[model samples]
Target: MYFERAHISDEELLSFYKQLLYPRMVEEKMLLLLRQGKVSKWFSGIGQEAIAVGATLALDKDEWILPLHRNLGVFTGRKMPLQQLFHQWQGSPLGFSKGRERSFHFGSRQHHICGMISHLGPQLSIADGISLAHKLRKENKVSLAFTGEGGTSEGEFHEALNVAAVWGLPVIFLIENNGYGLSTPVEEQYRCEQLVQRAAGYGMRGMRINGNNLLEVYHAVKEAKGHALNEQQPVLIEAMTFRMRGHEEASGTKYVPPALLEEWAKQDPIRHFEGFLQYLHLLDTEKISEIRNTLKYEIEKDINEALSATSPAVSIADELQDIYAPAPSAVPPPVTTPVAEKRFINAISEGLRQALERYPNLIFMGQDIAAYGGAFKITEGFSDTFGKERIRNTPLCESAIVGAGLGLSIMGYKSMVEMQFGDFVTCGFNQIVNNLAKIHYRWGQNADVVIRLPAGAGVGAGPFHSQSNEAWFTHVPGLKVVYPATPADAKGLLLAAFADPNPVLYFEHKALYRSISGPVPEEWYTIEIGKANIIQSGDDISIITYGSGVHWALEYAQQHPEQSSYILDLRTLQPLDYDAIRTAVAATGKVLILHEDTLTGGLGAEISAWIAEHCFTSLDAPVMRCAGLDTPVPFAAELEKNFLAKTRMHQCIQQLLSY
Candidate 1:
């Protein structure tokens, strides 16, 4: 018999059959509930249950699994409470996300399961990170991530696979070739004959197996896990299965051929397993009926309990909660005296060095950051001070690295990612805005990651490298935006970012990196985030700005002493210093907001609107904005000078002063 060839005992084979049958029963009941209008939505995993159950059963309890929407067996196989799963599906407060998310889109830290984002590819890189953590801690653990044949078409899929292969991370990438990705057929997805064939290009082991055969799937995954740990490499497995039901209950499968459905129906995993068991005299009609009856009763009981639980209460304050972890109240006071003067770039490097010395779990990742010391030399000599493992030099895969940072944070590690130039962040924008920024709010997982952006213009680096894109991230919730003007604030704010338990986008102007210098403390100190500093106080007009604009405002204030401008540097943009802004507006009747980003959709626009809304009574004149012209930065020196807002700063200040 096939079971004897695989060396499976009667008891073990029976257990596998039971595990597979449980999810099938659960799905059938859930489908009924959907029809009865009890559950909101359901992603049916009717025919693909064997793959999830087999792969999950093969992994150790401690190993992590990132499952997609169709991977309901992963949750059921892990023995997550049926009530909690029902609660999650019903959007009740007792669910893992506290009803913040729907379906399998929430993660359970207690169960070592990370739920997938709608953007499926990012989770693959996140798996790379979880495996990287295992490598760093020297644990013999492997991370398994699931995807569909269609998800392989995404750029993140390629980036994740290439990165995992390069790092030799212990990851198993399972592609359930379920013949369709939300209505699109496998032929439309890729030109390759099989998805596993692409693994050879990545220099990793590839295996293709019949997913409907429970024993074959279980043994393949078990062997893949061993190969990953022993050789410190990733494996890509393509499990051939078919989606017997619609992608979702609402999307009917009229697109599928009737003949194909009939052929696959005869190969139902549960029926096949039961036949095998019957041949061995280990099962009979009575046992099958008993198992179905027991599972149906248990599922109904859990569903009723879940339905009885109340939905989350809706409150104005509750809507704003969980965007970020509670900020630490205790902050080390800054040193009053300066140790020495240093450039902005040097201060950043020094701050990173000290943070690595203090926190053993802190890691730095970027392109050319190790021996090459990064494109901007911010991590020079860091590899020598901290080993290459901690100061990781990554490939040109920004999305994977950022997602990896999220994974590292999930494993209780602090990670800092440097975009060689801030504009390159577009390559990894999905990972930052969707995955990193939303993980905390979705499942109460703290994404303790710092992304250092070398932003701003005026260095003649042209449009691509010199963009003050802080406004893009500032608009996104669950992210702290910091733009430091001086060397002292640069070091202080960076250290503060490391201390904070949220995702921070720290923007360092390229122009200020070498041209700017100031007195910085040698000892480690953290400035409170979301606090604005009044660089120079005045009573006539308020010049509210950040980053490069701070320097311009200071220059204007120094040049025109008679104007008496109160210059306020907004270090943090997300949790903006509203109190300080109110103080500034009260101190000065007239205000002029300035920034390096273009006029439309800039941070200045938001600040201007807020002042108009809240501080309208205190303002003697209209709030004005001085920002870059509405055009892409030019390469020519003469055109660039005209494109910058610094030239318009004098004109804007004069207008506000006169008004």
Candidate 2:
């Protein structure tokens, strides 16, 4: 037993002492490593240990903790192994991210702690999804998501709070009001006297307390947890505190006021708490000194072990590996029998319905997705069939929806997110690119969420409503980008995406939504993700394309029967079937790559480059590409028509044939 005062038992106070002391010792040890050039950067949470320790200790083991880089106390409080923690800091092979990420930027699935992205506020929305899943599962768990006071200024903060409150989820948003965001003081960051007051605007209970008071923070979180478990009400608690050190080792205290530092230093949380323990006759000078000495010795030993540990034996193979989750053992073969013909939109809806039917944990979320059937009616009747819980209508917050899907995915659910149009994916670009796309490689976690994008132009929807943004996601690693042209492929690919344990960006061309119909299996089926389809077989020329481009390529092939061109539809863009491409290019020496996106930096460029490098000698002529001009899709009908017309494709094909 370490100490006892008032209602606190000796055992509990002893645990608190260990939590407080461990982080301090670890921070000190890491600082030495930084000086020795062993570790790269350090975020010292010296003065703010009380908040992390108190609140994290209050959580049940099953409850989740989403912490930022500075919350070393939370990891210590959760009893994470000291050696693993040191390995993470030292960038050793045993680190949770296998040395791929910085210290404190990784999560442990075994510990129920999520690795954090550098962008902070996005995790708030993700926490909402996690707590929402817990609520849906009727679990007696509450998720605690932490961020600095400055992070509240991010738009995702408001979106997360609003969604949690609206859905009555069991999530606790803890803002460590640590006086400053780097060198900028809190006063200049926001107009509110207290950050907690903003919670009222989001329709959630809010509180403000001195973060240095360990007992105060603990009781507040306990009360919040009770409310969350019983009432399913989300709470936001702003713990006013300060960072004893600069943001990182590189940022010195030159930006901080000397007098202000002295003032905060006087009320140092650990020192003040120790004083309280001494006054209560719970801890004496001798015992306190012994505790600190023991923690320092243990942390030093762990640091030595970590330093001796070898770094990950990195090679090009290690860098290339683990981009996608391992493929499933058996992919169900294609259903040759056709139940009925369906439009591309209906095919997608049916595919979603089948997925939802198969996986009870699957959820469908988007703006107006429930009752209104989304902007395109793809999810029509979903709310009635699957109920409001499974088929959710989200706010016009694209980033939040995507972030929430990631959170839900972390909780082992298949979350399908829909962008009303692919053009709006820009709104959620940060979450998609920085957060969702990198989750797998960063922490060995599978983010099994599918983002449905209604992409491409033809129906005069202009630039914002009609654009092929597949190139944006295809260019990114750790993401599978699939663009299916036909209804059958749409249904099969969507199902396959749900089964595969990776983040999939499914681009459904809006032009083919209702205009095109094809044979689709009535029963559930899955098409392999990285396989290309030969829509037409010929020997003269090879046309490689996907999405709406497939239609143009097929039309061109059908028109020029004498030329005998083979049309290859790349179903999935990222894990492209290079074998099939090689086969086509070798068979038909002449090749033309087509796409609906702009010419420069399009997927066509990648295909052309690959053909040039690998199939260079096989080429009868120079590989060619015809795509939209390097300009925005015009709102004018004539301009748009000329921008993505078959005439351009015909001109390219004629030039290739002439060559």
Candidate 3:
């Protein structure tokens, strides 16, 4: 898996680079845009051109590549339309953001390559997940992920490497070590001798190559693809390159030493690679001249195309596109399928396994969800049975994982992408909020994606790992928030989410890993998404809940037989079955909403407002809600429970009954 440094003509290493410089030219113009007060901020992949151009040669156009903001050359070199990119830099209607996202944060799902995020380290994990889908589909395509040396400092980078390495996923983590993570020099960034060696920490092999050498970049990526596709393991290639200029076209060189720039300018990748090609007799002087002149023409053409590209067609409809999958067949069997018995995790696992079996397009992705069976072992034995292509373990980049899920879902794959810990979802908020949520609203529901978060606090998971931010998602109008309280609902709800046309955020409570077990059906079933599930019939009070709180409400109903109470599990937060809630509220006259998220904006408040608005006439007393106090989930077990929804759920139910 190692290749000695050799300069040869067997492979034209400069294939991607020959056309890459043109984009760098565009980068300069983009900087002009910043100066003109067009773009607010810009992150250019100016110096690290070889990796972007060369790596594209190792990947198939049908294969996916999720580049970070630093690697725009890959898209331009790969023949991504210049107008689209120009639309991006200019923040025009044609820009990938569609008026909502930041500049240069563009991705074209149609091209099979999604846009990139500015945050360090998320793209690595996102690429790992997409590779999982390609593997599951049994496609030879590998996902090519890009990042820079400074991104290595992020825990997501390590998390992604470790998970993809362990799962043997078909993903290539291309770490372009171009010397700095912003003003901080790499030496200040890390203590490692070579960044690639860090891969060993995750039990993976890595290598360093002269990043500026296009041939070296190509050779490294070729080997990486082999290890990735054939071995199903991840590979890290530290392309040791240098940036010749400031970070952005507008960035001042106050921190970047003039001597270093002079030294790097001498090693210009564009000139160096072209000269190397001629020295190797791969091209004559005439070809070199033609390439330079042609690249100049091309670069100018890209700029003109970008400038005159009709501003990407001003369309309000573009905003409604690529948000969620299509709605399930409204004619789904009206009667329920006979339910059988299974465990909670098994229900979710089996439902996904069965969904994969039933739907050829369904794919499962998350950290250690394949061979290792997920952190909770829900997907154990799944990869072996469905093969790594279907059940995939991704790199631990939450944002990238979510973004790549956005890409594949746009590719028409029903992707179930997860953030290992719900808390980690913070790593990918932009992807979730901007991309996933807006896809439907922007282009009339043009996306098909399912994002899963393992949420809530329990099991002594401390602060970094535990969170229930379902309330945050409830605010997103285009996304459907579904949190099941039972095994059967978990299976059924997932089935529905996969089938639903809009993006669905399925939040799985970590605390319920074992506490809230129920009989899941052996037969495949999908509970309706966006609809609440009522667990118990009551007359005195209505305990409405979802996820973990649903169980607590049911337990309360069982324990307090003295009060006949009804329970409605708002299985979904968005498109909340207000009709269902009103019906329940009208009958019960007293409502208690519960959840594990913080109280300030907990989903309960929304439900209460909706009920108070529509069913105010039916209320016997006042509607009340139970939720965790607004605070981080404390590590102390007793204190955490006191801060959790269990105590809150009981209190709310008690208050409702007393009312």
- Model 1 alpha-carbon drift over 4 Å, by segment: 1-5, 333-338
The residue-level lDDT of candidate 1 at 542 comes to 91
Where does the lowest 10-residue lDDT sum fall in candidate 2?
1-10
Across 1-659, the per-residue lDDT of candidate 1 in tens digits comes to 14322777778887888889988888888888888887889998888888999999899988999999999889988899988888788777778877779899988888899979998899999999999999999999999999999899999999999999999999999999999998999888799888999999999999999988888889999999999999999999999999998989899899999999999998888888889898878899998888778888888888777777777576667658888888775355455744789999999988899889989999999999999999888898899989999999999989999999998998999999999999999999999999888888888888999999998889998999888898899889899999998888998899999988899999999999899999888888888899999998899999899998898988887888777889999988888999999999999889999998999999989988999999999999999999998989888999999999999988887887787
Candidate 3 lDDT, 104-170, residue by residue in tens: 4556665666665566566566676577666656788788777788888877677677767766777
- Using TM-score as the measure, name the better of candidate 2 and candidate 3: 2
Candidate 3 is scored at a TM of 0.76
**lDDT scores in order:** 0.90, 0.87, 0.73
Candidate 1 vs candidate 2, lDDT winner? 1
Give lDDT: candidate 1, residue 596: 89
